[model samples]
Target: MAFPRVSILPLLLLLLITPFSSSLSLSDTITKDSLYQLCSQPTIRKHFCIIWLTNDPTTFTLNFYGLLGLVIQKTQLYGYKNLAMMKSLVRTTTDPMLKIPYGSCVTYYESAIKSMEEAIKFAILKKYELTSEAAGKAFSSINSCEADLAGRNTVPSDVPLRNIRFKRMCNIVRVFSDVLTAKNY
Candidate 1:
């Protein structure tokens, strides 16, 4: 059987566009997977990163600024939860040293939540540099709180492990911000 004659112009256009379109789609998929992998890097909590980063479809579409907003939101949520637990400890603990450090931890987590709020606003405004700096400070504050608890020999068994999740989330956002900023994306 013979095929009917086709216009070469349309065929040429299709040939030209097909590879470009396919490659673009493929790259997007690769980028999404890379994000999941980057989020689950050795320094971070792999399972936690994988679960959170992959839970929503929008997470894959976010630019660095948008990603920063998500990170800030998560940080605030975690900080608040941890703060409440610390407050409970402060209220219940009989040991003076434990009470003081737990109280201090509550204060630090509050500051972190405030800083993360700032980071979220900056990210929303597309001010990634400000967002990065704010997030970095927030991350540092949590680290400082953990350090204070350790120094006082009042560190909760869960605080260090919990901080690892915070570190990973903040660090991933920082990495994305750095790449986008440096590339002027």
Candidate 2:
């Protein structure tokens, strides 16, 4: 039997477009469960990660890099908050002992904020190692601040809580960056 002739162009176009379209849709369909799975990776606090990421509506639309960027942004904001708190402590406290540690915290948080900004830039560029390094630096800064406050007998209760939360955010960035690096994405 003879077959009717059909153009191969349409078949070629479909073949070329299938993979790209499917991948695009896969990325676009990111949901809360997928985010939870990502956040539930070992060494990450699943609950904390989920709550923070889901708090912003835009997070549902982000891929891995975008999610990491959001975490870095949150870390930067927390750094600024800590800086403001330290500044307030330094200004309002009459005790020289309190002033010494709070003053140091002010400097540390300033450095942390700078590091977070660097992390954000590196994350955007998909330089996962650099992003992790920047986040680690920010984490170290928070640790230093905590240590300084530890020696003081009159440290404010809220200061410690803020430091803990800020450190957690930095950890999330570091872990997520490491995952991206490992995947070589």
Q: What Cα-based lDDT does every candidate model obtain?
A: 0.67, 0.83
Considering every candidate listed, which one attains the maximal TM-score? 2
Per residue, candidate 1 scores C-alpha lDDT tens digits across 1-185 of 99998779987687556532132221243356556545543445667777877776777777544555676787778778887887888898877878777778788888877887887777677666777787787788888777767765546678777766676677655555454454444
Worst 10 residues of 1 by lDDT: 19-28
Please, what are the lDDT tens digits per residue for candidate 2 over residues 71-105? 88888987898899899999999788788888899
Best by lDDT: 2
Displacement of the residue 27 alpha carbon in candidate 2, Å: 3.8
Model 1, 3: alpha-carbon shift in Å? Answer: 18
Worst lDDT 10-window in candidate 2: 20-29
- Per-residue error at 91 for model 1, in Å? 0.7
TM of each candidate vs. truth:
0.70, 0.82
